[model samples]
Target: MAVLIGLAAALAGPGGTAHAAVPDSPAVTYTNPVAEQRADPHIFKHTDGYYYFTATVPEYDRIVLRRATTIQGLSTAPETTIWTKHAAGVMGAHIWAPEIHFIDGKWYVYFAAGSTSDVWAIRMYVLEGTGANPLTATWTEKGQIRTTWESFSLDATTFVVNGVRYLAWAQRNPSEDNNTSVFIAKLANPWTISGTPAELSRPTLSWETVGYKVNEGPALIQHGGKVFLTYSASATDANYCLGMLTASATADLTNPASWTKSQSPVFRSSAATSQYGPGHNSFTTSEDGRSDILVYHDRGYKDITGDPLNDPNRRTRVQKVYWKADGTPDFGIPVADGVTPKRFSSYNFADRFVRHWEYRARIEANVSPLADSQFRVVTGLAGGGTVSLESANLPGYYLRHKNFEVWLEKNDGTTAFASDASFHQRAGLADAAGVSYESVNYPGRYLRHYDYLLYVQTPGTATDRADATFHAQ
Candidate 1:
């Protein structure tokens, strides 16, 4: 890997500068086990139109890296270990969060781990790769990494500003206890810290103080001339939260006083949405440079039950990154089941809309029906007579809501244009013991009844066919 470290260093340019033709919205693709049995995922979009994702897999026994053309592929794509733990002492074992980055024409991977004999000695380290193709590169184990922590450190991120390179990560100050804090320092190279580490931010905010005295995993992003230092807070349990510290590009980034930490969290666990402990996120820009996405992992349940290690949740998740009017993140609530956002897709473009196909919809209704009127189209889609659009497996269920839409798909291979129209208003979403509606099993949104998601009143992409249903590879 040392021979090709130059290939990883090339990441200093943000993946070749030529972006893919991404839409105004970046698509959020997910891989449930994003390299299953892994934790603390760190991803990088390479200049090769594919994303390279790596995580800490205690069971894998090696540093694993996976690449895919699309975001969703990362979960299922075949993975290769660019490097593995060697002897004891320097670059021994217990590898975690091995992130490959390109800077100054070299390929370098940043990770945390303990020596073969000392598990608590986990610290940041780098591997020098010497090839353009990361998998083929010869990875040489580098020496011990210097970070903000004089003692323990991990989750290191590096970025360049004003022709100068900076490194940020979670650490434990010598004066402080073992609790990790976010800090920044000047970098001499991918493996060297040039200057003393400065305190950038801490888990001081309410959300930051959610679990134990936590705060670590800093991913630095400079967008719209604003330096956003995003980090994870709390334990890996339900208390986990995502926090941000923002400042102008001209400000002293190495100084802690220059940044202002947001009191509220930018992202957090949504028990209702079945996404909990959403943190340790990295930002990815779409091919068109318009879409920004935050990718992380979460659990379906909130509480840490009998065993923390055996929990089945903690699956990787992907979502669009939104900005508020105040120039900050506006990650509204997670899209609960059966609800989708309509504004961005439908209203943004007149004819462009979301559609679903080859899906099953079934619902059962009573004489004293759930609602006075049956379910009907709300906006874009409309059936003049014996529905020209082919639909299968719909039973006696009324899909009506005061404010809702549907995304109908035809039996034919192609999808139909988006349609929306109000349905008979009555008690619908209010009841959680929902009717026996045939819908896909989605954590956030569902195909309630024969309910097709329409254009108007839709909330987010959760209502889009991509979110409600799945596609075959």
Candidate 2:
């Protein structure tokens, strides 16, 4: 599910000219914290061409809904207070993690709430919304969702596979003294659990067991014939992170044995990036509806004065999700702040990505610690209207031509580096769906790999063009 730009033959430049053009399918650049003070985010894109967003507000008193034609629009979209906690009773206090879902022509919101008498008496609840627009619709309380020994239950999510609907949530078993664990069961109705619940995962790893042996916030995504259920673990502080469970699309989801838990977290805090406790994520699609995006919340800083729950800086962020060759997701690191860039993979070698080895350009297998392979595709050198590839890990260094060879060199703000670094992005001469990078100065000569090393050479035949084409992922 990586965002990719296909190769094109037309030469267009950065300034919207024909000298060298940006990728025909340009990358959608966006900043982090799409909305402030929004935690446990859930973004659902409906068929009506609008993305609906809901999450736990800092006050933890009510559920809110916002919709936008584009993802970025949610940042400024006016939020409607769809439902509030009851003055007394089961849902009278501490409303949290509200997710809006449209099922069977009716909209249902699954959320967690506590009692005004006892805030620790947390349980799952549902709100039914009727009408075309959720903002203007009427929401009615559907009462508490009864589960198998729900000592502390919350974060309810649902998904369907092979026409069978299933519900997954975080709950504490009566026999267990530790934190919550993930459970799954077949759903007879939106609010009714039909069968016995089976345990899918618990906090076992050191990362998950940190601060507290907790597992909560189960979100589901079905891709590549597989179901991936990601849940948050540990305390809601810096130790809070994301873990995942995988099962085949055809497998019996109701059986706990069908799902396998990841030994390590799939996504977590990135101290270098200033993103802490990145968990409680929901999955949605890009504007083009061609890429899967991960929507989650994380604190900007690590330090907090009082209880982490009281620190209301957790903001919503979105990034594209990439899949490994084996069809599993590679969440990589919680990326740094700013417009996230993409990686380049060779068309001839699907597993190999364009990277730097000793500051020299080469193609290698896409593996863990993916920062080395990522590059910021920016406007070309000297304002020549082309494009330049800047290293993600090494900010000042860029891919430049030296002696007709590509190398990662530091940007010295010199004319030579600027000219050598520029490249004309064009469509694949061999593979029409792929992309080819031709040297801006050399014109006909293109960037190609030979014996794993990248060099500038004129493509003569289909084989030469194929070797030169790359997928901008």
Candidate 3:
């Protein structure tokens, strides 16, 4: 985690270069565990210009909600308990994973609950909210959403594709040995399933069957001509992770054959970041609606005492979701705890990003510990309306140019060091859409990667301009 040296150091611009505004870029800084003790997190950015948040509380006794205009505001947003579980019958115990959605101008919450008598007999249920503000809206209880079977079921999420609504969830098949499988069905309405559900994915891969053969928490996002369904797998401990299923947007979604499951988990626990059991994710767009954000929950520690379900340490977190050249989402890894950092992606080599390896700065793709590539774009250390790049995981260290070569070095609090560390933010030399960094001391020299190594070089050709230009994301 980077340490703040002064007020100016903390006063960085939000997620873009100072010269030009980039629409829909991520916020400059947001602390992790956006909401504490909140698991199975879900975030819904509605047309009302607010981000609605819901999750399984540690108590697991009621459905609660909160809203904020921005993702950062959600951390301190006051929560309102809109509904509670029944005493003993249906929707009575283990109230969990409540996801609020707006369907056909009405607000609906899809959640899972168990009977008090049979605490493990969980089933999916719904609640309807009457108005624009779900926090203050009149919520009416709508009974359980009947699936094909009455056995163990949970984590129900809904989405619409080509004007047709579909509900996807996890349910146990009595005939199968696996704990649960992901299923999808057409939704006649927000609270009712119209036809038989198709089993899209099950836990068969080694990573999926880590502690238990489980597949649950189905969340969908349609992008790059494909419908991507992501779900949690394995037991809810250090082994818990996320798996994905991909299908063509035009395919018959109800048919299992349409979806192709990834052989490995798409996202998983990152020991380097100290985030364990990272799964059960929801997606929301940035305030500008340009960047996609990954919202999920994980514990800061790896071990749990007794049952993982009883542990209350799981906390809600959010990070920007990157994309691959192939147009698929690149989750990267769970970042280190601190102000959420940004990765400077090369405009020319979209796959490569600014990273530090062995204290030397360079641009590389798929760097390990990901924190090595993440940097806090803070206000200038030299105080000249410039910016300084601070290492995300290395406190007090920054990217400083020495002998024209950029290296990760600890702050020495000297004028020369500060001047060497600061850079004048400039609009991209090659592409106006991105940004280029000019050295504060050397007026014409700009930061660029040569042979994958970072250096301050004066641009003389188109290739140098392309190499100097980067998108801060």
Highest-scoring model, lDDT: 3
* Residue clash pairs of candidate 3: none
Task: Identify the candidate with maximal TM-score.
Answer: 2
Report clashes for each candidate as comma-separated counts.
68, 10, 0
Candidate 1, which segments miss by more than 4 Å at Cα? 1-35, 306-313, 333-473
Instruction: Summarize candidate 3's per-residue lDDT along 313-376 as a digit string, tens digits.
Output: 8999998876665667767667666667898876656556899999999988776656688888
Off by over 4 Å in 3: 1-29, 347-352, 356-360, 363-374, 378-398, 407-445, 458-469
RMSD per model, one decimal: 14.8, 6.0, 7.4
What is candidate 1's lDDT per residue for 367-419, written digit by digit as tens? 11111111222222233221122211121122222233443333222222312
lDDT value for model 1: 0.56
lDDT of 2: 0.83
How many angstroms is residue 160 displaced in model 3 relative to the true structure, after the best TM-score fit? 0.4
Candidate 3's displacement at residue 7, Å, is 42
Pairs that clash in candidate 2: 7-427, 7-434, 7-435, 8-427, 9-427, 12-20, 12-21, 13-20, 13-21, 14-385
